[model samples]
Target: MNPTAPHDTPADLSVAAMTERFRAGDLTPVEVLDAVRARVEACEPTLNALWWSDLDRQGRAQAAARASAERWQAGEALGPLDGVPVTVKENIAVEGVPMPGGHAAGDPPTATADAPITARLREGGAVLVGATVMPDWGMLSSGVSSRHGITRSPLDPSLTTGGSSSGAGAAAAAGYGPVHIGSDIGGSIRLPGTWLGLATLKPSFGRVPLDAPYLGRCAGPLARRTEDVLAAMQVIGRSDPRDFSALPAYTGDYTRPLSDGGADVRGLRIGVHTDAGCGEGTDPHVASVVRATADALSDAGAEVVEIAPFMDEGLLADVDRFWRVRSWADFSALDLEDQRRILPHVARWCMAGADVPAVELMRCYHSIQRMRATTVAATVDYDFVLSPVAPMAAFPAEQPMPYTDPSLPMQHIGFTVPYNMSEQPASSVHAGFTPDGRTVAVQVAGRRFDDAGVLALSERIEEIAAVPAPVRIVGA
Candidate 1:
């Protein structure tokens, strides 16, 4: 910890805190980035959370940091995220950074220009320090992979960080700067956010643009502070001509509601779904934390009601089946040698998709449509629906999924995946901790286009039951 540190150490500085320091002329962008770089350097060897960095981009980051510092000195900040340091998940394309999507095939091509989200971040003055790791093509929920290796949780090095958006979650929890951009198709953002005990928003579909061409994928913000997530979202959610799905006009300043202390849930109806609606039981400790969170919301004057499961058991299996088949189709286009480079699990999934008939795939789409309607209906009467983010907490880093019995198949993705299918706004907030120190997260989901309301409820929950500090990297 720094000798001049205030209430919190630099290692766990929040975006709001850092910006306040800058506004008071007490800190500079370079100083903040230097602290963040030190933290990343100290933790990188142990956590292996990052895939690549912008530091070696011909000194571009250096120039940008200097310019940001000068602006802070002159009281001419660019926007809400001015001088905020952030990390982008490796799957998101940044100009000059290779978006290999964690594939091990050699000689991946670098992105020619920044993805729409990255471009907005640059425009808002959030310094891009690096890119976090993910599984090959973001195929798995766990961080373990053949390409970037395993990404352990900063909370406990032995625990998996939870992926597809693995490194983004790990880095945010390890305090590699305040804000991070994560992509979620099937709970990629919220899963890691849950395991790492950070606040993450999987924005409603089309609330944020899709830079990389893919279905069911949306880029959203992840951060230790909900305020930062909101700030980052304001920038990244801006409409771009490139994205046909972009909202007609940006919903400016997501932090506005929270700033005015308007996120009160006194009259709000929040439904709690713990069984995951798939007939799967949540791990005891995980369920307890979520139940306790519900009680906390009740104490805060919100009407907490136990609700039946909103989704079917087959929802994620179908989604995965569709993705696996789609992934196989894409993999088949690769050369023989490149095909040989794919991860074993990824290949297995791809093969699983290969044999499925076109009619079955069409059935999968209809199922998803039904699932979306059911989820939307479930939340129609309630302001938000609360559930456990996952059936279990973080597991061993070496494993693929946190399944106790491999033969039984894993239903760990029960809660968050349905929200993805529904394309509604959902967030994972730190509910509490497990006996073993792993964090538990409660999912707060709202109707379509209610991204702001979802976040507002999360902020209220945050105020009522505060999240813990970032897990300090031992050596750092």
Candidate 2:
């Protein structure tokens, strides 16, 4: 591994900090990537966070970093994330990387072209180290997959790093990489961040372009700090001609000045949903963490109100149907044998999609489309809506994933998924730790295009909570 940079701080240096170091000639991209590579080599045997690592290709990345450093030395301009090393979740295509979608047994075709977001990262001068692991077809909440094995949390190797962005969160928390690019359709990014004590952004739909098949899923980032997330969003947020679903606006700057005072939430109306429309049997720890987070925001000068109407219970079925249709579309392309060989939960979820009638699927789509206006209208008076990312913190990794738990109601995903169905911007910041030592995350939902606002709120909350770096997995 490359020797640590002279001025490199062991911790608290986010991706933005590292980028500044690169620009000031204090660090090199090669050094950053090498450090990450060494960490992965040392940790993967226990954490199993990576799907694949192309060290030879990374050598080429090092050469490219040298060229970028030379250009900067010659006074040429560099992008915001120039020379930063980031990891992409396996589901998103990275040109030349196999698109396993988390099922190693299934011989899915390799991606010939980069996903739009991946291309944007490269254009911004961020080096792609490798693809992080995910659940098979990203169908479950825990990281146990037949393909990649289980991914443990950095804090405790016995606990899970939530999925389907499991590896992304694990890698970030473990300090294997500064930023991890992940996709969230149903609490994937936020849930992991919550469990691992990290900051993650689930941008408004279309902010990051996702080509065919996975279009409904929003691409996002997981990182140690909110600043790194903001820096990454600036790059991957670019509009792509390939995704017809992508919005028409150019990428806007996500970094902004925090509110005047650490306590300045003045005039900002915030809504808190402790019940989260999850019906009965919500975890007390989850409720307590969320309420505490709301109190912190209220103490920060924001008017926090308990609201229920903002959450629509009718939206769950439609969201389920939407995912079903998308999963079916992707699964149909695979050979029958390949389909059979996929993870059990993935196969079960995709099989359910085959049963949904075309008319019913259309109804589900139309229902979601029509409700977006209503959902947006309900939040017009509030600057942001706060809630829990998941019903509970990360659970133990289960072998045969549970698709639908009879004990937990359909609204188990209540706090999330609706925003995805509405295509609005949402984010999760580390609130604090639970009594049992698990991390807790608070969800922030903002206006359709106001992703920056959501990120701003996260930064403020991070200050109030003072989240600590996740504990590295022991004996890895």
Candidate 3:
């Protein structure tokens, strides 16, 4: 799309590379957006990564790109990412777009104003290409949805791209654009990042403000390269008045660590979490990739050690129970006719909470508190912890869950959910591939409020591991 590299290989499609070409007069934002939109159109028939809303996304994005080109020609460009193409999650409100939450339940109304994240993207001069699709209410990690249908991975059409952030992952892997923003409550961003072999960050709970922030749901960037994610965080990481849950605006810089040569790791203690303590144990191949990644960190002058499993079936069960009750409450409030439109598995999963007693719900809440405290204390000694993004690789796109049952829905999230409850910053980078070509990735977790440090370390690990990038598309 950028004309330097073929559409399949996205090396030149990265934000940093594209903007550099624009500055040298070798390209124009209009040209790039046109080419990008074309590529997306070509891939859409198979990937199904974008959501079609009533919003005039194309006209608006084209206008923004034209303005950026004029600014560059007049030497008044806004910033490095002035004309970068970005796709927002459909759930996040953009002016005049309905917040469907990926469901066909109601006559969803349009937003009168942009969400904080969307507003920041506009202020930073990013062109809003369109919105990406997600599973219903972001409840499942798989791509199947009642509203958007199944979003198969670009790398392997049979396998899922993983979700809540489903369409964003599919778009990134297919090179739709450099920035595809998504929300991560329990590894929604990083899970897909791993399955699709992309780079994504689920920053500290409040690093990027959300219009309707929840306990551990934070909005962040997803791209093929960590550099692009950093380019995006530079803009959306600002403070906003809308989210009462957000931390004070971030004052630290995210770019310096990369420019100044990543984080100094000579003395950093790194912990390797090889066992998740519940669910099907980590696949041998997945465990091996993680260990190799840790070895690379050890070779980089950091102290690496193994950490005992601090999680169990009970903790994961509690998380599932708490979320089920939350989902049930939301589903109950919807109009009775609308509730019937939910995906069958989701309906079955959430409705289980309808019969729970108040005492059971309180116990689930208390178990979450225990998990938070335990997760925080377990990693206190290490500057960061390295683990697999999941216990296994991607599952079939048509499947509703890895376990394929609503009652045991979240067995795959054990390695990721604790961090959400603990409010820690975590990221996923491509590690390697399984023997069968399924993508494998590792998660990097850092102390609370150390969002920048986590990213800097993640970049360094990416360099050290140097895993081969998955092909642009596999089995297409």
State which candidate has the highest lDDT.
3
Q: For candidate 3, report its TM-score.
A: 0.95
User: Could you give candidate 3's per-residue lDDT for residues 1-476 as a string of tens digits?
Assistant: 11243443322377888888778878888887776776676678888888852224458888898999988888787876788888889878899887788777887678789999999999989888888999888999988889888899988899999998999998888877789899988889999998999899998887788888887788899988788888888888888989898889788888666323556677888899889887768999999999999888888789998999888999998888888999999899988888999998999999988988999999998998899999999999998999998998999999877777788848888889999999998999888889999998899999998888888888888778877778766322
Task: State the lDDT at 284 in candidate 2.
Answer: 84
TM-score of each: 0.94, 0.90, 0.95
User: What total of clashing residue pairs does each candidate reach?
Assistant: 1, 0, 0
Over 1-476, each residue of candidate 1 has an lDDT whose tens digit, in order, gives 22133523554667777888888888877787778777777788888888887664356666687888889888899987788888898877888887787888767789899888888889988889888999888877888777888888877888888888899988887777889888888789999988888889998887887665356678788887677788788778777888887667654556556332576667778899788766357889998988888999899788899999866667756766777678888788788898888877677667777788999999988877887887778778987899988888888888877764322323677788777777888998877888877888888998888788788888888788865654554344
- In model 1, the runs with Cα more than 4 Å from the true position are 1-11, 56-58, 256-261, 404-410
Relative to the unseen true structure, what is the C-alpha lDDT of residue 258 in candidate 2, on a scale of 0 to 100?
37
Error of 2 at 120 (Å): 1.5
RMSD of 2: 3.6
**lDDT value for model 2:** 0.75
Worst 10 residues of 2 by lDDT: 1-10
**Candidate structures ordered by TM-score, highest first:** 3, 1, 2
Angstrom error at residue 122, model 1: 0.5
